[model samples]
Target: MKNQQLQSKGYLMISSTQTIRIISINETFDPQGVKIVYGQGTFSHYSKDGLVEDSIAYRAKGAAAVSVAEAGVNASGVAIGYLDIEVKDSDKGYKNKICTLVIRSFIPTTTANTTFVPTTSAPISPPASEENSKQLVNPVPTVAASNGYVNTTDSSNIPF
Candidate 1:
């Protein structure tokens, strides 16, 4: 082995493989109300002669495609932010070797399509009153943040 290509003692190499790899990512989302969201898991590294830098820069195209999108009134995807990776090699019990990455997959854009043809037109239903119209609404009003919540994922928000 060459003197410049040797691994150091202590937490070096991903697991004694003499090539410990470090990773970085953007784990959260800032969907400016586009009705859609996307994420990518980027990773890359070149073996160093010594201590590895804590932060690595990912190529703009290096970000892996998370290709997740949802549409509709109240839709959402994965939690936004970094990727949570678990690494092990008889070190630190293989727990939390990497930081917790949250996936920002929720981006509110448009609501449900109103043009959906009614199922069987209610057989010549009588004109709906103001109170009745309110009740007929598909989504019941609640304390939902004018912004959607992660508790539920509605249609249109999903690529399907």
Candidate 2:
């Protein structure tokens, strides 16, 4: 058997569903956080009936590079974590498959607070594309460096 390498591209045309989890965030003028998000990507294939298929296997692993000030203004975690990714699809036979998906232009609609787990509190679940004015308190605070706590975000200034 020959060893095979694979890569594919999925396209999200018009609109698609996406979900992102903020693993960790650091305090800074422009705070950067790690995120793992998956959503319906570009159409990688089509059925015999001319129906298109969206790939959920592909994901965008990137940073939530937003500012505390910006977060305060938006008052939405989903808005703060919004991202635009451009990369290959992580699916079987993707490398060998023909790619027609526009990876760079994939954007979702109506991002809201679906899941949030503060360090100290239980998980917070809110509806998508809605506003929740609940305050968030960091249950487990991080160590302070010369600058300050990296994962620290002033709850008073933010709305969860």
Candidate 3:
């Protein structure tokens, strides 16, 4: 079936195998007053070289944001596995999204989930590469003096 038809029926699927190391979750309100739990973290995907750095600000805010927040808190160093992008009906509009992170079976081990270190062989040159793909991944590390957090991604890639 076509993706659009599938989406209309309340299914959003990402065909990639991905992983996310959640750094932080914050509760905020949208202008429309909906509770938005913003999650920012590092992302990696299985490549021929094993897990390679993919993006940052792996924001998953919406229906599953609450769960993401909870997991981050209770599961110290929680690593969300088998992550996928899903879209369902929402007040916002058709195909409103919630990044769905699933647990296949066993719980994640502590070491893998705690920290996110970029494994990109080269530094990310932003606004060019990211813009072409229309997805914002934290290509560079933020200065420590600025904020304690790793870094939030640019606004370009968030599909909402």
Give the runs in model 2 whose Cα sits over 4 Å from its true position: 1-33, 39-47, 63-105, 110-160
Q: Any idea what lDDT model 3 has?
A: 0.53
Provide the lDDT at 123 for model 3.
75
Q: Could you tell which candidate, 2 or 3, scores higher by TM-score?
A: 3
Per-residue lDDT, model 2, residue 153, is: 63
Candidate 1, residues 29-86: lDDT per residue as tens digits? 3354222223232222446665433432211111222322222222222233333344
The superposed Cα distance between candidate 1 and the true structure at residue 27, in angstroms, equals 20
Q: What's model 3's TM-score?
A: 0.32
* Model 1 / residue 160 / CA error / Å: 71
- Encode model 3's per-residue lDDT on 1-160: one tens digit a residue: 5456776999865543334555666777678775556545565567889977644444444545555655664242343434455567776656765554443222333432366687858776767555567656886556755677656679898899
Decide which is better by lDDT, 1 or 2: 2
- Report lDDT (CA) for all predictions: 0.32, 0.34, 0.53
lDDT of 2 by residue, 4-39 (tens): 112223433333333322222333332454443332
Off by over 4 Å in 1: 1-79, 90-101, 108-160
